[model samples]
Structures are given as structure tokens and as C-alpha cells.
Target: MREPLLRIEGLRTVFRIPGGEFAAVDGVDLEVPRGRTLGVVGESGCGKSVLSLSVMRLVPPPGRVAAGHVWLEGRDLLALPMEQMRQVRGSRVAMIFQEPMTSLNPVHSVGAQIVEAMRAHDPGASAAALKERAIEALRRVRIPAPERRFEEYPHQLSGGMRQRVMIAMALACSPRLLIADEPTTALDVTVQAQILDLLRELQAETGMSIILITHDLGVVAEMADEVAVMYAGRVVERAAARALFEDPQHPYTLGLLGSVPRLDEERERLLAIEGVVPPPFALPKGCRFHPRCPFAIEACRMAPPALEEIAPGHLAACIRAPVEQSVAA
Candidate 1:
């Protein structure tokens, strides 16, 4: 296996609350090899978004990275000074937020925003040069009439076009790693497919790694080289995309896959994971997922299980992982 372009170890992000603090992202460990995409799949509030923000060191106020290291090309991002980390954020690792409308500046022209993103890393570049590069970036993402669209505000473009602009700004600096947090949310199915295709094509062209944070398993099936199944704030399972889809190990992962409708497999109706994601402050004992796990047993209530290898390169936090036996019982 090749060395990963980005590696996260024991990452924990916590937010302040009334009593104390609760971890929004708890002990997540993942990697993204060069030119590959790592899909992070989980339901809303499962800490997937928080984990991405932690990597960019952009966790909001009242929320902070309390533990672990975010290593990017051998340097520990968590240990870098604020100014140094700022330099690394866009130039080396950029993010495309979930909602482009909210993420993009409402008042600024799309072209100007991309220019600002580029200027941050290349301050010495001339305004004209930046404008030309910004337009080129928009064109690269397959946005037609890029020159005209550059001057338009976020509200002026359609949802799909706005999303493309977000992609353009993120890729403006040509970062090595692109963290896309639900990049296709709210778009129609056709537009969603286009965005995913654009991402794959761009990755092929740039050889940049992507950390795709999404709740859609269908998207994962289409794009991820590897998949991480998150539950409550931890990575409950991690495996190669093929292995994960073919043979899921953890109960939460199984529940998630079972919930997605499959054309190949006939089912009377889609399955649903029972109960809600336990609130961070009110997490359960032992396995965080025990409350919703149909196969959970007494052992699951004792203490939190550690992420352990169930097969070569496949890891799951459940002790009964390779959970087929539990399924049989």
C-alpha cells in the first residue's frame, strides 16, 4: 500500500454545552491515498461534517479539536501555528462545504470569490492574472460561459451552477486534498450525477485525493475507493469499498447498507435503522450503537469496543464483527 496523502489519527472534536463538553467527532482515524477518494457515510449528526472541519482546522467557535493528529504529507496539522495552518488550508487542503448558497458569499461575485481564494495562497499574483485564472477554474469545472458567470452573484445562478462555482473556488489553488462535505445535497438527481462525475474527472486530471463526506451509500458505491461507516461520533467500520459493500462487518454498517435500495437485490421494502442517532451529550454506554443494533448483546453494554481488524485492512468496532454469526443467532 502507498503512503496516504492525508492521515488522521485518534481525532476528537468537542463542543461546549451547558454542563461541560461533548464530542461531535470522537476518535476518528482515516486516510486518503493520493488520487483516491475516501467516502465517509453516516446519517445526519453522526459527526461526519465535524470530522472534515477538524482536518481543515476550521471547527467553529465553542467547538475545538481536543485530541489526535491530522497529518498531511508528514507534517502534523494540529501542531502547526495558526498562521502556518492558514497557509496550508487552501493551498494544500481545500474544502467544498455542504450548502454552496450558505458557504458562498451572498454579496460577492462568484469570480471575485474564486479570485480571493487564489489570492490567499498567491498574494504576489496580479489582479488580472488572478481573474484570468479564476475564469479558467470555472471553465475547468465544466461551467459554460464562465466569463459571464464570473460576475454573477450566488443568487443569480441555479443550484447546480452555484455548486459548480463552489467546486471552482475549491480547486482554484489546486490543493492536493479536497474535502467535499455533501457536495451534491439539495440538487436534483441529474445534477447530482453530473457533480459526482465532474469530481471523478477532476480527480483523474489533477491526481488529488478527496475526502467525500456524504450520507448517500449510492454515491459511495459510485465514487469511493474505501468507505468509513460512522455512528454516533466514531468510525464503527472501515473497509475497501468493494469489501464493505460485499461483506459489511459492523451492525451499524449493515443497517446502513440495508437501508439503501438496491436494484440488483429484490426487497419488499427498504430497511430502516431503528431509533435516532443518540445525542452527543447523551451517548450510550459501551457501544454507541447498541441502542439501535438489533444484534446487540450483553457484552455490548459493558464498555466501548475498540476498532479492531476483522480481516486484512478491514476494521470494525464491534466485538461480534463479521457479524454474520450474530445475525444467525
Candidate 2:
């Protein structure tokens, strides 16, 4: 059997708030195979973005990965020195942030940023060579007249164009893994599809593995081979995308699937998962999602359940997975 491209074991990322510390991401374990994409889906603040940042060691101050091992191709990334990790980041792994505008430096032209990224990993590359590669990267992402766009600042481009530039920079290094956190957050539906198609095309060409973090289930269904549904800092359910979506196990997962407006079924209002995700500082004693889970019982409030394999290659954290429902809708 081949080894996983990226594997996370007992990953726990925490943050310090006003009163005390909060475990933004707690005990997450996942594996991404080579040339595959893992879609992490969850409501906002459920630690989806935090998980990606933790993997990259880019969690901003007041927040850090407090525990666990991040293994990439048999090496423990968590144990690597800061300088070594820096070298590993762009050359072996890269990320496309949630918002391109905020992620990009407004002061520098788009071309300059791409060139700088290339130079960081391949410092031997001359300025002329790097610039040519930068322009070629832009062309690769299907940007019109790449030479002109290279000289423009992020603010000058439309949202879609800016996103394309972000993708270009991330792929310029040809890293083995790409962690994209909400890469289509603000784009229109059509543009969203285009960006997704572009990513698929690039992945097909390079055989790169991707960790696509997004709240959009539609995106998950379209892009992911495997999906991990997160709730309150932990993955509540994980399975092949079709299995998880069509035969959801956990209540949270069911609620998420129900909330999506399916064209096959017409409904006046979408079913929503009741209650908001509680702040990590005030997380519930047992299962963090028990408060919002309609089927939660006394046992559920007493102790959190470990993620157990309910079926081959399928896991769910809820003790009462594949919840028993009575007849008659």
C-alpha cells in the first residue's frame, strides 16, 4: 500500500482569548491521498479554516497548534525546525487564502508577488527568468493578456481575476499539496464554476493533492472525492462524498444536507440547523454539537463520543449514527 501524501494525527490547535484559552481545532485526524481532494465542510466558526491554517503553521498569533503530528510523505512536519519548515511550505505545500484581496499585498504588483514567491524557493533563478515564469503562471490560469495583468495591483482586478491570480501564485511553485480555504467565497456562481474547473484542470495536469476547505456543500459535491463534515471543532462525519451526502449519518450532517435547496424536492423554506455554533470558550461539556443536535439524549450530554468506523471507510462521531427515524414524513 502506498503512504498517504498528508496525514494529521491528533491535531489540536488552540487560541487565547480575553478570559482564557479556547481549542479552536481539537483532535482532528485526517489523511489525503496523492492526486485526491478532501473537502472539509462546516458552518462558519466550526474550525474548518483553522484546520487548514494549522496544517500550514500559519495560524496567526494568540493561536497555535498546541499538539499533534503533521506528517507529510513519512516526515513529521510538526517536528521540523522553523527554518526547515519555511523551506517546506512553498516548495512542497502552498495555500490559497479565503480572501484574495486581504491575502495579497496591495503595494506590490501581482507579478512582483509571484516572482518573489518563486525566488524564495529557487533563489538561484534570475530576475528575468522569474518574471518570465510569473507571466507564464498568469497565462496558465487563463488570465487575458498576462503581461498587462502582471503589472496591475490586486485592487485593479475584478474579484474573479484576483482569485485567478491567487491560484496562479499558489500553483507557481508546483507544490505537492494545495490547501484552499474558501477559494470561491465572493465570486458569482458562473465564476465559481470557472475557478473550480481551473483547479480541476491544474490538478489533472500536475497530479497534486488538494485540501479544499469550504462551507459550500455544492462545491464539495462537485470537487471532493472524500468529505469530512465538521461541527464545533471536530469532524462529526466522514465518508466518500456520495455516501455522506446521500446517506448522512450524524444529525449535524443530516441537517447540513437537508439545508441545501435540492432541485428535485421543492420546499417553501430550507431546513436549517437550529442554534448557532457556540464560541469555543463556552463549548458544551460533552459533545460540542449536542446543544444544536435535535436527537441528542442524556447519554449524549454526559460524554462525547469518539469517531468510530460505522462502515468501511466511513466514520461518524455521534454515538447514535444513522439515527433511527419513525415512519411517515
> Evaluated with lDDT, which candidate comes out highest?
1
TM-scores, one per candidate? 0.97, 0.96
Which tens-of-lDDT digit does each residue in 1-329 have in candidate 2? 57889999999999998888989899999999899999999988899999998888889999999999999988898899999999889878999976799989999999999999999999999999999999999999999999999999999999899999999999998899999999998889999999999999999999999999999998999999999999889988889998887788988888888889987899999989898889888889888888888878888898989999988989999887767741121
Q: What is the lDDT of residue 60 in candidate 1?
A: 97
Question: What local lDDT does model 2 show for residue 158?
Answer: 91
Clashing pairs in 2: none
Q: How far is candidate 1 from the true structure (C-alpha RMSD, Å)?
A: 1.3
Q: List lDDT for all candidates, in order.
A: 0.92, 0.91
The per-prediction CA RMSD against the true structure, in angstroms, equals 1.3, 1.8
lDDT of 2 at 178: 95
Residue 219 in candidate 2 has what lDDT? 97
